[model samples]
Target: MRVNKLTIAALAVVAGLSLTACQNDDTAGTGRSDSSSSSKGSHSGGSAQDTAKDSAGNDSGEGQDTAAGTGSAKNGATGKCRTDELEVTAQDGTIGGDEDNTVAVTFTNGGGRDCSIAGFAGVDLKTNAGTVSAERSGEPAPATVLKDGESVSFSVSYPANDTGGSGVRVTGLVVTPPNETKSVTLDWPGAASLPVTDGSGTPVRVGPIGSAGQGS
Candidate 1:
């Protein structure tokens, strides 16, 4: 009877040890599965972050390109009118009365781009006596922008002597556009004789540049 009891106790102890070994194996397997899942999650998060960074980088690059394009456009804007790019002409007309003779000087933009002009042109009548520079009128001079093939005009005015023999004989005109140092020479559009003064004895006056047909 004593031997049987001892045998029973030994069997119970062996069973308990086997059960503990099985529990340990299950815990280890669960820990390995949790570690693998965590590693995969970390890899997925890293990939997402990388993708977001790349998208942000692309957006930043595009913004810089747009700004560069705007700067380039500003650098390539239209400039001021040049004397060599204009075609100038003169025509004869009368104001107030037939005795008040006027010369309309027209400037046409012959360039390929738009340009600006303002104020009075420097006008000097080439006379047999010498060069007579014109006086500016009190009219308001505004800035004028001229596109390709567009034209602007100003006026040079003097009274007709009609007395037949007491005036300057103007043979030509030397015209310089506003703010320009160069000049162009054109033939006088009126009779060779021009009175240096008006009825009030005002010297020859020049009007401000204006749109076509606005001269005088």
Candidate 2:
């Protein structure tokens, strides 16, 4: 009876040890599963954060470009003048036959901004034999910045030749702005005839554009 009792007690101890070992193994497997889940969640969060940073960086670069474009347009100090923003006219300023026969050509800035009308302006006499060329002056001067509604006048003068009915008769004149290709045709109000040679070889004389009226 004592040996039987001892054997049964030893079997109970072994069974208890096997149960505890199984429980420890299960706990270790559960811990591994939980760690894997946490690692996947961390990776997903890092990917989302990287995407957001890239988007914000692109938006910031685009905003800077837009601001630069706006600033350049607002400050037009070094901008060149356009032909569509000007108002041109011509009139006869001739006094008598002995004096210099002059024609006043005026240019006015019609826009709300300031611009420059410097350099030599090209002139053309619109005649039936196409257009006649004009000579540009060689004098150098500073450029005048014309404000809104400000005007500048330039004169085209020539020596009077009161011969017979032999001089050319030009009905109008075409004036070209400096560094511009477009031309404006204005009426001529001088006299019966202009004492300029035809388009054979001589070119009409032109002066520099001067300030007119009272706007600085």
Name the top TM-score candidate.
2
Candidate lDDT values, in order: 0.84, 0.75
Residue pairs in clash, model 1:
none
Q: What tens digits encode model 1's per-residue C-alpha lDDT throughout 1-216?
A: 999999999999999999999999999999999999999999999999999999999999999999999888767756778899999999986656453578889999998878989999998888877777888877899988999999988888876767667688988988999999999999999767876554454457789988323444
Stretches of model 2 off by over 4 angstroms after superposition: 1-67, 73-78, 97-99, 196-200, 211-216
Give the poorly placed runs of model 1, Cα more than 4 Å off. Answer: 1-77, 95-99, 196-202, 211-216
Q: Would you list the clashing residue pairs of candidate 2?
A: none
Q: What are the per-model numbers of colliding residue pairs?
A: 0, 0
> What lDDT tens digits, residue by residue, belong to model 2 across residues 50-127?
999999999999999999998988775645566788899888777654355777788889977888878767888765
Each candidate structure's TM-score, on Cα atoms with residue i matched to residue i, is 0.59, 0.61
- Judged by lDDT, which candidate is best? 1
CA RMSD per model (angstroms): 12.6, 7.8
